[model samples]
Target: MKTFKSILAAILIVGTAGFLMSCESELESKGTASIGVTDAAVDAENISGVYLKVNEVQATAQGKTKTVVAFDSPKTFNVMDYQSGATYDLGEGQIDAGSYSELRFILDEGSYVKFKDGTTADLDVPSGTTSGYKVKGDYEINSDSRTNLVVDIDLRKAFVKTGSGEYKLRSTARIVNKDRSAVINGTVSGNTADKVVVYAYEKGTYKESETAEPADGESRFENSINSAVVANGQFTMAYMEEGEYDLIAVAYDENPEEDTYAFRSASEVDMMVAGSLLSVLKVEANANINVLINLDF
Candidate 1:
């Protein structure tokens, strides 16, 4: 009886194991059938921070050229997945130069792009191009989801201005050469009065001679050229007649003959009665004004 019972028990165990295996297989097959693949579409609603380009540029009030990038701040961009027709909102993201970022779309199975609202109408993903995704729309508020995704964006550009305005020509001169190494400074008068008298020429002639003296007590020259002399060694001639004038400084050293030397600047400025402005032209704010001087030099 024991031997028969053992063999019967082994057979029953085998049969039960086989039945469980078949039931598991059937359950898996039913599950697969229940999960039927279906085609669906998604909705694209809110979008923001769309980047656009500008063509023309303008200068600032300060005469500076400026360039700028356009973008929306505190806005949310909506990302739509094309597959399963499901749409989700992707929060605001940075849009870098030379490239763009957008939501990925899903189509049949792993296929995507067709579902994206921005995808080309014909829904063709071009070769060599990442995908054919277009910016659909932009919005400030989220009406449907009630969930607000804020988008913050920054834009930047580089621009350069060519020239700068001319500054008032308030220059000073001092004797630094040998002999008359003394400092010669002087004050400018008239429209050039911006410069204050600092020093006079050490020892130099007006042009060629050691001292600029009146031709005679009778005053031969009708108009006396206006000149400024500083205590140190610098002097300036204003309202000078349009003519070639040489500048020289006189020095009183132990030896009187070679004590004085003539000096000139590396460059010379010629004044034309017609071309030169009688008065300084001042540019203030946005308007230009002509300034005249009446004080004696």
Candidate 2:
């Protein structure tokens, strides 16, 4: 009897050891693996379409809030028809920041890219043009909250196709620090299209502008300025030394009668500078003078 009991106890102990070994082996097999982590890539989904309108423009030679019929809904005009319309969709993965990588807009009968953050683009359509634009700048998505986007546009690019029909517009825009903003506006007539080359400079005219230039020899010329097309009629200049300086808009038309690099107008109010800021100055004359360039906020 004693031998039988010892044998039973020995069997039970063996069985328990085998069970424990099996569990240990199973754990070792599974324990060699680890958890994984990843982030899904943004895809081309949720983007239905894109629509734009233009009711006003601000140019270096002209500044007005003229109402036009082109500020309507989508489908009336197709700027991307040449690219199979669907290619220009601006939702979900189609756009990064505010600009599109594979974006195709029927501009000047061709397409241009809006890369480089804070740089404005100018697009021109038949009989119209957009200016003071950037592909990446301050923007919001779905109005959820305000965030800086990779794309932006001013009046120059917004007014490119306002006239309807098959026409071409010329425009540009740019991005700079929030503390600096400047604009240049101009018009290209049907004849003088090829003979125009424009350039801009800053001139300070105050105590704080002691280092500013006043056109030729006004003061110090800071080379950090930037320019871009904002919309059909607006061009933004940025990154200027904070002080009162002339925002000189020069146009070079090859006509012998107008061959000099001339100002867009005479009443052009030279800037009275102080600190780094952003202001939307109105262009209203052959040259506007003493026009308050409000750079607040």
Count clashing pairs, candidate 1: 26
Score candidate 1 by lDDT.
Answer: 0.22
RMSD of each: 34.2, 20.2
Residue 255, model 1: lDDT of 27
Candidate 2 has its poorest 10 consecutive residues by lDDT at 33-42
The CA lDDT at 275 in model 2 is: 38
TM-score of 1: 0.13
For lDDT, the strongest prediction is 2
Candidate 1, residues 211-277, lDDT tens digits: the string is 3332321111112122222322234322122222322212212223533222212111112222453
lDDT, candidate 1, residue 57? 15
Candidate 1 ranges beyond 4 A from true positions = 32-297
lDDT of 2 at 170: 28
